[model samples]
Target: MRGGVRVERQLRRLRWKLTAMFTAVTVGCLLTLAAVTATLDRRAEERALDADLSTRTAAVALTACFDPAVGRITVDDDSADSLVLGRPYLVVVVDWSRDPAGAVVYPARAPLGPPDLGALRGLRPRVGPGDRPVLTDLAGPSGGWRAAVVAVPGEGPVNAGMVVLVGDPAPVREANAELTRRLLTGCVVLAQLAAVGGYWLARFSMRPVVQALTRQEQFLAEAAHELRTPLAALLLVARGGLAHPARRVDAMRDTVRLADRLGHLVTSLLTRARLQAGTQRVDLVSMRLDQLVEQVVEDLPGADAVAVRAAPTVVAGDPDLLAQAVRNLTENALRHGRPAAGAAPVEVTVRDGLVEVRDHGPGPHRVGHGSAGTGIGLSIVRWVAELHGGEFMLVEAPDGGALATLRLPGAAARPTRA
Candidate 1:
């Protein structure tokens, strides 16, 4: 019982470790994906804002260039007013030729006051590959702003040399902030879900391991229980032989039988272990099933009390396993087939890849002589039959006895010589 508890604790620890590893990997992947998505979204928003600022600046500059007034530039057209009036940005036309300190032409009423002219004039206009004006970000008193600076080409009295358009970037920053918040929330939720899924997957994977361990523990307990009685009897017989010299011969004979029984029990346990652990491989060959059953019957201790009727039936199977299976069936029948009045002998039949053993004794539910043997023998028979793609079954016969059948897939019977 303590061993079982220790195994359970160990299995729990291993399960938790596997869950932790799986959760960590899942969260790492989710965080990486979120980071990449946030970055791409920020770049997309910046591009859009830059494009809007550039388009407004170009419209204002074009209107100022074609103004009818001369000796002084005035942007009084509807198009220029529409681009700058009541907008979330500032537009200033600087006349370097008129006043080197810079001049603001549009927006007669300044809300945030005039922008810093020295800073505006100091900025170097970025030209793209197509000679398009690229917007630049500037730090302002109120907040950060994106500015597009465009220079008028022709030298005329009406044309302002520089058109500076500045737009507040608060909206873009707010949008990016919101996007970041949503991505973080989504990542947290996904991480929780991943942890749950990982734990479930770990438990699912450990089921087979748990079952195998349980089976091993049960096998050990059964083996110990089965060995205890025979070992005690053998020891008692040896002690009695030493105490009484007259009964030494009988004691010696009984000792041999008990030792043989123990040996057989141990061998059966080992065979079961090998079959369960998959250490034993079935070697398939074409062989005569009837001959195998006959050989098994002939080797039994009470061969005279058993009757065999076999046909020329062939099957493809592992010869060793099949022989062991047949031998176990015959032995089990002989041990349990005796009635009080001495009924018919145990009947063994082989027909069309099937071996049938019918005992005219008590049924399977009743305990009889030699019933102390562990049921491992039947388990081995079942395993061998299954390995050869066949089956084994034990059923109560209608004639008040037990009938055991071993069925295998039939192979073509060998050709007889003329």
Candidate 2:
């Protein structure tokens, strides 16, 4: 995989993350709203049920005669026959020994056929006016019902009187069920729209960062081309100077010096290009960490205080990039460590998985401390460290200067493998 090309499988980016977050929150809100509304509807239904029970209690209470010996519930039969309850109502009077389902001695057929007596068996047998009504969710085959069963006048103690009851649920509850369904559907549609909006929000929010990266890419291409022109010019001037070195000794020296400086600049640019384009992967071979560090220190302009700790504490990594990282750190330390009185020598230490660069200059000026190498060196250090599953940190040096550390990962550098 190329270095700059970071492939995110989906959830790694902000758009999907926002969409998922909004969806979760929306579902939760809708479910809670549905639950609260359902509970309230049930409470209201009970109030309606109590009102129905009061009317039934009044009618049953006033009736004068129901004696077992007489075998008849005496009443104003003409008025009872003419009575009509607002909703579906059934008033059946079973024969003393008739099977509840087999024969309806006087089935009230005005409503939905004989009351679907399966409901009659379930009614409360003795509920007077003040008794709390027990309500439930089952509605009889007639679509709605609230029945109260009064005992027969004969069974005085246990089931003392005949059962008298009513039918149907309150109108409000029936309507509530339909209302809730409509609300939930509306919420689902709104949530889907919210998720789509969240995705676009994330996309537009990230536009500036994308634009900055594009500009950097373009700048690098132009800069590399510009540097090549000077490098070629210096090389040509060196060739002319070399052809007449006896007479142009000074010119020859200047030409070679310019060529060297140009060559160094070209290398740094290429490293940046390779890293940015995402195509720099290095093959590892057995090598000595102690030797590599020593070589980097030797190659530096100043290595007086460079020190190696532990035997070659090697690891698998891109040796070229690693060497470059160390050199950059050394140069950075030298550049920033020029003190009022020339600063003490910078120190380099390698131990465990870490390479520490410590200087005794008066730390960084406030301008540079924020991200440590808003410049080139720290950036390269940070990238190389993480690419190897390690890290880089800039800390206050115990003495005076800043401490830059690169902690890397890999097997310990050792002797050549068999």
Candidate 3:
């Protein structure tokens, strides 16, 4: 029991290992998805900000006018009011006509400090008459900002003035920050869900292994119990022979019989273990089912108790394992088939791709009866039938006995023995 528990605990740890592997894979995929999403979002935000700054700079340039009389650039009253209402923008117009061009701050209603004007001078504007507006990024004390510098039109050989418009990118930055937080939160939830799903998947995958292991442990315990009886009898017979010299021969005979039974039990255990472990190589050959059944019946301990009604059915199977299956079924019938008074012997039938053993026993009550190693014997027979791509069934006979059937696929044409 302790050994079985240890094996089960070890298997449980394997389940966790499988779960951890599954979860790690899921998390990796999710992390990749999150990274791609964040990168795309950042690019999109940058594009939108660039477009916004260009549009606003065009608006400022369109509204500015150069007065050659004053040699200064000025905005109309409406444009001046609108520009002042817009927040987080610095508009400056520099007069190229002046030596070291004089810079004029737009939206005069709103004050532009020395530092803001000083930052605008660092943003070089096009001084040529027809140069296109230049868009660039500017880093400030607060954060990053986008700027568009355009040459202002004037009646002069050289450009009379230059318009510089700068826009703060705080809104886009705030939106991207919010999106990142939400994406991370969603990833966390998805990771938790993946962990849960992985745990269940691991448990589901291990269910078959657990069942097979449980059956193996049960088989070992039953084999030990079966061996104990013959071993105890041998010990008793040996002790008697030593204590009583006159009846030593009788005790020796009993001991030999007990030892023989022990040998049979050991052989059966080994055969069953090999079959269950799928290590038994079945050399299938062309054989007649009736001949095999007759041979197995003749060797049975209670051979007289079995009546054979076999037809000539040719099949492809390992004759040795097939014979073993038949022997186990006969032994099972002899042990459990309790006939009524004058009832016919236990019947063994071979026909229609089926080998059936019917006994006048207590019908369905005989099923699951582990007494005298019946369960393991039937188990071997069942496994043999399945190995040949067939089936084994135990049903209540119509005449109130137990009916055990081993069905194998019949050959299309009988072939010569290989």
Candidate 4:
């Protein structure tokens, strides 16, 4: 089974350190916001609970009525029944008073609700003029009572007496508490969402850096190949020159040419190294780009084969580097393509600050267009173009050959946008 099946594995595509940090920070902020919201909501709810308790307590105490016809104190059943039919309570004491032995229940009173009315003595609350009510936490066999006590007011002396206590279950408080729990849960969920979003955003934001790195690796590989080829050729030619009789002018001229070629190679290396090290200083100036191309065409390898097709196009830039890049392109085509290859008589055209090196040689159709010359020639051209913030394009010519085009902004061009 192992041998038959393809081992399918996925690699991590994101920078873990950056993504994790973004997630953590976002989640941390979300959690803090959630906690603050929960806290504020709970505080508002607590204030709400306090307000509700006041209203409810006042409603329960409204049962007091003065029986002026009998000159006695009593509770209005209609008012009390209005509270409930079998109203749930911890304890409801109809009569109570404070004494040395603590609160004692009056014998003539009635009791209702559960047996949790044990602590109905301490809840001091003002009910009316010189009359008070008490609310207590009562202990019980099963649970407890959050009780309220109030005095029944009388119009005359009819022994209408003091206390009336009532209580409800503790679960109402639990309901209020549950509201806070739900809010906290929502806050936690929001925090998790923020963490996930932040991670993806962090990864997306830094994608450019990853792309730059991948391209740099490819460029280094190509650069190594380019440098190796020229050095190899120079070494072979130098050894041959040393072994042969190089006393004649033609032989001396060949040696001089070899040294000059090597010098150009070294200069290219320095240009790249300086740019990489941030030591390359840009010298932007207003100049006629068309004139620059014409001058460069004059110095091209096998200058006789290069023909000017149009007038000069001007732009502002470092003229020397731009000229060198054009020269490199011409040299590459001349050195590689021969008389019979139909690549003869290279064409130079300039318009709108754009330079084109067109050849009638065997076209790039023989090799893929994407190949940046598996050699050093095109590398030097691209490096110079990129150094000046210019653009390059290589394409097969209509006449069974190839063309290299370079475009750069001149002094007359608009400023770069940030």
Highest lDDT scorer: 1
| Candidate 1: tens digits of C-alpha lDDT, residues 254-327 | 99988987877787788779988999988998888888888887876778887888889978998888888887
Ranking by lDDT: 1, 3, 2, 4
What TM-score does prediction 3 earn? 0.79
- A best-first ranking of the candidates according to their TM-score comes to 1, 3, 4, 2
Query: lDDT tens digits, residues 1-418, model 4?
Result: 2321321111134545656776677667766776676667656654553444344445545655555676544555555444434434321323322242332322223233334333433332333443434444556555654444455555444324344444445445565467557756776786577667766776687667655554555556666665565566657666676777564445556667666766666666666556555687768787777777777778755688777765555566776677667777777666544454543457677777677777666676654244333245566667667877877777776645667787675422422110
TM-score of each: 0.85, 0.44, 0.79, 0.67
**All models: lDDT?**
0.76, 0.59, 0.75, 0.56
lDDT of 2 by residue, 1-418 (tens): 2323553333236658876787778778877888788778777776766566546534643452455686545554444444434554444443334466642322245564456555555453333333333433335565665655444443444333343445556465667787788778877887787778767766677666565566475545456554665566666776777787674777666676666555555565566667766687766555566677778988765466454454567677778988878877776776566343453466677766567777666675542543222255566777677767777878776556777888776533431110
**Which tens-of-lDDT digit does each residue in 122-231 have in candidate 3?**
65443445546678776666666677778778775656667776667787778888888888889899989989999999999999899889878878887877777678
Instruction: Find the candidate with the highest TM-score and give its number.
Output: 1
Q: Which stretch of 10 consecutive residues in model 2 shows the poorest summed lDDT? A: 409-418
User: Which residue pairs does candidate 1 place in steric collision?
Assistant: none
Lowest summed-lDDT stretch of 10 residues in model 1? 409-418
Question: Candidate 1, residue 162: CA error in Å?
Answer: 1.8
Clashing pairs in 3: none
